[model samples]
Target: MIIFFFLQSKIFIACVLMNLLIALCCFHFC
Candidate 1:
């Protein structure tokens, strides 16, 4: 149970980081 929750949070962080990166790229290029 603990491992499952940890993995979920890790994935959420990764997704947020990815979104930030994408937004920065769009802002710089467009």
Candidate 2:
């Protein structure tokens, strides 16, 4: 159970980072 929650949080963070990167790219390019 603890391991599953850890993995879920890791994935959530990765998704948030990806979104931030995309937004930054868009803001810089457009």
Candidate 3:
């Protein structure tokens, strides 16, 4: 149970980081 939650949080953090990176790239390019 704890391991499942840990993995979920890790995935969520990764997704947020990716989104922020994409936004930054768009802002810089446009």
TM-scores for the candidates: 0.93, 0.97, 0.97
Off by over 4 Å in 2: none
Cα lDDT, model 1, residue 5: 100
TM-score, structure 3 vs. true: 0.97
Q: Write the per-residue lDDT of candidate 2 for residues 1-30, one digit (tens) a residue.
A: 999999999999999999999999999999
lDDT of each: 1.00, 1.00, 1.00
Greater-TM-score candidate between 1 and 2: 2
Q: For every candidate structure, what is the RMSD over all alpha carbons to the true structure, in angstroms? A: 0.4, 0.3, 0.2
Question: Model 3 over residues 1-30: C-alpha lDDT tens digits?
Answer: 999999999999999999999999999999
